[model samples]
Target: MNARHDHSHQREFNLEDREFRFLVSFLSRETGIVLSEHKRQMVCGRLVKRLRSLGMRDFAAYCALLDSPAAGAEVEHLVNAITTNITNFFREPHHFDHLRHQVLEPRLSQSPKKPRIRIWSAGCSSGQEPYSIAMVMAEVLKPSEAWDALILATDIDTNMLKRGADGIYSAEDAAHIPENYRKRFVRRLHNDSDHVQMADELRRLIRFKRLNLHEKWPMKGKFDAIFCRNVAIYFDKPTQRALFNRYADMLHVGGMLYLGHAESLIGMNDRFEASDKTVYRRIR
Candidate 1:
């Protein structure tokens, strides 16, 4: 019994060097994400369940399947498994504050004739960032009937997209929302006190979709502001450079680009000038 348990454990957890290299290459090619040597164990842990579900005895079999024609259906599952989705409601408070003060507030005086406003929450994991943006939009663009505003929330992970579309979160998750906004935009489900749903008004202002940044973007119109925070940390410099260039092309002149706290474009791109800490403006 002990020997059998040991063999099963080894088969489940062991990630061979050759298999790891193949996965790294495949992930980079498909998703533009570079998995380093240090991530080997994490890859092993994340994919073990996949192997079990497919009756795969080892990483070698999984890699073979991915390399085969049968990989089409498995590709999405692989992407969903390995992609990290760490986010929370109002994770970075300052970005929302900036959006309210610099991006949305100024629009109040410029055009009451239904001025268009578009904000993209790229790599919007589990929907918190976009919902937070919606809250601020509701607060700043008062009488909400007058503004042509929309938040495009997108992520490569379909599971996360579903969660974002559902707009339901735990009380703990909703705690980050300010009390005033909570009172107005959070709905408590009867017989459930631990979880709450985002109000319809906020949901009405957002659209969630699956978007892989490595591939072509289908969005045709230019955006006024983009919140792509904390997502670039996964890509290599070349990928990051290309992605930022695309972002610059997608934004209008003087439009805002909000990045993660740890990310910056100092030597990466010249099209943007820093507007605040980790925040940039497309300057042509």
Candidate 2:
């Protein structure tokens, strides 16, 4: 259960129609995260803590704060509160399998000109996906010194980016990662066995930054692969289409794009052909 989890049990607040509409419009305009009428309860539930934290009594006061002169600093917290960061290490294993067997392995046979490898973890939450990817990269390209490899991990939530950069995770989080990668990329804390840290070698391969997908990306060169899984499911079809096209533009001609199991590019974008279930390869 993702954002749909019932939150009606929380202390209820009077969320007026005007405030809700303003919220929906503001979120959609600023971050491309659409909040439908049906999601009002979920939105309220997610943001109730913010209201409490700001010492506001109700949604009206919260909405007022968003429109006030002090709104500049709160916008970051607003996005952090509203967005759902549902992710796990190797949440979708098949994609990484493909990245290993199909993507990285092929490059191993390339000409002596040491190939450059770039992978993007769009909406990477708390760093697991990119770190998992880093493990795969370093494994496939060990003596990785020969090749230039980098993983750019970006998310709209600055908090998530900071956590990802920190590379610390609950011990339970390490359970989801496959054994081979687990041993190689992560190590348990000597003092606190409850947490694990991504190894320095793997950490060096990633760069985490706060980014709004709706805004123009600052990256110059194309990536060899992009993992935007489960990100666009919250966006409207038109937004998803536009985002996918932008991803296509940012990828080399034959670069791979991995989506969530529930997401696909069918009827949305034509520049890609399905190379595998929930995976697309740029063709045009």
Candidate 3:
């Protein structure tokens, strides 16, 4: 009886081809994320909980809700469900190392004016990437008051943005942080040893906001570096080309752009010249 009930529930939630295609089209148009035929299962799996939460029995009903005028609010929820957020403190350590040595350190030693450093973590999942960047910035910019340094952490996921602004994480996740940074920038909770929070100092160095890359960006000033890692992979070739061109415009000449290990600008855009592994310097 239990097995039969579970099977029935599963059958009720099956996504039909029409509904899957609608989802693929809606997602691409709304968020610039392309969902191909192979991603159908992944889409279904990820959105099941959203369906269940809305008391939906099938994908057809969910699709109808998305198409209706009432979808304005639900749209946010749908995009959040479809988007993936996976990151860690110093997930790609090499990028951080490059940021320190090639970007920050040289500016500190050679630049005559008060150093002004700006970095954007374009798809910063939660808060880890920017926080890792903040740690390095704070370390290099001695007597922090002397330098104007800031990290802008942006994501389309409001939930992720909130989590990043809160700056709290599981204690075990702290293991990923370098020992020196851990000691200096991580704070133990008053009574909860199971969790930790980013130090106020590091938190002060960052600004978190919800931004869809497909939309117009609000920032006016150019950045010294942009870490858009792992994000362009979700976009199609045309979208990736446009986005890279936009990044080039947002960066200063000789500023750096960091891509995910799987992402490259080889033939995508020539505005940037390769600087290091998965790192490119804006030349024009």
Candidate 4:
């Protein structure tokens, strides 16, 4: 290639490296999503659109802007922009099915304690996971003064939590939801769009918050079940092990931990015994 072509290529490569390193560092610090060297292009491509939208001249300047005093709000936007929040109502049905048929039903039949169920969606993005749990509980557990249930939906990304709290979604977002749930829990928009909002009852049942798994959790009591699916794949082995140990500590004896299909606690900790594929139970 000519000298000018070589210089242009070098500039592009340097910019790509800067963007990749900045994103990897930022994501790891904020949410613990470890991006490997191979993911550099993916990170660059994803953020390039955002950079263009913001009218940034280069990745270096973008990183500098992110370091400013106004960076807190910008950081929230950055995290939301880059993190993959691809989720839908009941995206993984088996976990909820197990919660309903195995955990809740048995507890109701056997326990003498008042019927109270607490579930934490540890990495709930835009609220679908926890809201789905709420929907199941609402259907199975009668709405009464006697029964108590709550779903704590938490994520490190505050922007996603805001969207989740808003409880509005495009019509296509609600497409995969079953007809019964669709009718019972969602109100369709009349603007000829597929947008829908979660019903007041279901929205009330879920409490959304911003939580980082690496930080000290403010939750006081052990939960009956914790849904932290598809969140640990980014952490290294040690982090994963520590996280699972914490999950075990935070769960009631015999409480279940559901992981994503691509994730597992295998060889990480002994406190949880594998109950099934993508599911672990607190044994001790």
Candidate 5:
């Protein structure tokens, strides 16, 4: 029975084998997102909708369309649709906790001059991560005079960056935000369902930009902290190693690197020493 079931599954997937390989190769080459063999069905399932939406009957036709010059814009949409961007405000609470209690507090206390903190949220999807950082900063530094802190939120998807720049969120997205933050930094809308808009002050602190991590980064100056959580998982080992090195160069000595719970720098680079799971400090 098990053998027969396995055979049936293989037969079902055989139809898409070639198209699946093409999509995996195309996406990997273009976006640096590698689709593993286990994700074959997921690729088909996610992109088949796009194929249908584009009026293409089959995956082969969709691949052909992707190869066309006219489809350049469409390719971005396709990648954005298929890529997962699941995140929420304060999703990883401990990281923020550490930043506030461990890093920011000590820097402020030790520095005689007014301290300016810069943080980059490398895969800041829809503004949650960066906004969360801003909210924490607001708590630590008084809003009236402490305006030098900046959070640069960036992502590869322009669609996501636009949403982040708008700073609007549905009620569900605001659930994880603390009540005090929700009241102070977010304005509730009466007519627009249960949505909330980020207050101007908080919004002003975050600068959103579309940044492709695989390409050369245009920003100058080292950041005090960099939150690149969950962004490097799609990249291959070499890319991951190079990215870690670049991040080290972009961070000030003793600056911290926060990664996703599932990610680590083990054997990747020597510039950073592991401070904890998903956390590293620039040592060199």
Candidate 6:
């Protein structure tokens, strides 16, 4: 092990105003993440671990290192440290409810033989969101071989993408998945039943990739539905507006767009119409 591991975790640094402003600007410009004055302590708390890991004693030293040419490669690590990864199976259950009843069911029954079903989980932190979509689809698209159901799970954090690809979760998380679906889509770990793996069928349905929503997206086709829930909450209004417009462009006309309960498209864009609480349908 490293000698740094022996150091006490109580190290503290008084972050300076100039450093904070530079950090805020840098993060916003590079990642489109708006860091406000109120988030100073939160930013400090998150980056403190990074500084300690790199043997940085003060925020000024950290800032100097970050501004240096050698720091070009560290931004992803910085983002991994700062990006929030809180997610779970079937989070915001109503979204799943809407997805099942309003989205998938109707598609399954479409008369002209709809063989393709595409869903995008825009901020699929740790895989749960996309897995949830897969679980629902697995049940709805009976004899799953009949449909080309695919889920694109994307996040800016590479670490989160790895975890999502691994498809492991604390066993406690199983409770959030509906009982009927859980048995088919979840498997207890061999040595530890207290943890679980998403079943192969579920994993097979999702394609996890790293995507920074603010940057140019390389995806080609329009999706039938896009679940960007809770992701826009951190972006400024203009960013949110631009993102939603881009989502609008990427979604099929009449496709569904699900937002976090705390987020809304009100006064932001006109391409979508409210179809359900906190849900919008692409209309234009």
Candidate 2 residue-wise lDDT, 1-284, digit = tens: 54443454233465778999999988888889988899888888888889888888788888888888889978899899888898888888889899998799899877356789999999998888998899889999878888889999999999999999999999998999888888777888998989999999988999999889989899999999999988998799889989999999999999999999999888999999999879899997
Model 3 lDDT on a 0 to 1 scale: 0.93
Positional deviation of residue 31's Cα in model 4 after best superposition, in angstroms: 2.8
RMSD per model, one decimal: 1.0, 4.7, 1.2, 3.4, 4.5, 3.5
* Candidate 5 per-residue C-alpha lDDT over 1-284 given as tens digits, one digit per residue, 9 for 90 to 100: 99999886555434277777888888877777887899877776777567667776577788788888878788778777767889999988899988887678887787646678889999898889999998888888774264468899998888898999999999889989988888888888878978988888888789999877877899988899999999899989987988899999999999999999999998889999877667899999
TM-score of 2: 0.93
Per-residue lDDT of candidate 3, residues 235-282 (tens digit)? 999999999999999999999999999999999998999999999999
Report the C-alpha displacement of residue 39, candidate 3, in angstroms.
Answer: 1.6
Question: Which stretches in model 4 have alpha-carbon errors above 4 Å?
Answer: 1-14, 49-55, 66-70, 111-113, 190-193
Q: In terms of TM-score, which candidate is stronger, 2 or 4?
A: 2
Give the Cα lDDT of each candidate.
Answer: 0.94, 0.89, 0.93, 0.82, 0.84, 0.89
lDDT digits (tens) for residues 1-284 of candidate 4: 69999787446435566666777887777767788998776666666666777787578877887766766676766766666787888977888788888788887787555678888998898888887888888887765345777889999788789999999988887887888988888897677576788898888788999887987899998899999988898788878988999999999999999999999777788898888779899999
TM-score, candidate number 5: 0.89
Better of 1 and 4 by TM-score: 1
Error of 5 at 61 (Å): 1.8
Q: What lDDT does candidate 2 reach at residue 108? A: 86
* Per-residue lDDT of 166 in model 3: 96
**Candidate 5 pairs with clashing backbones:** none
Model 2 weakest 10-residue run by lDDT: 2-11
Task: Kindly give the stretch of ten consecutive residues in candidate 1 with the minimal lDDT sum.
Answer: 7-16
Candidate 1: which stretches are off by over 4 Å? none
Which runs of model 2 end up more than 4 angstroms from their true locations?
1-12
Structural similarity to truth (TM-score) of each candidate: 0.98, 0.93, 0.97, 0.87, 0.89, 0.93
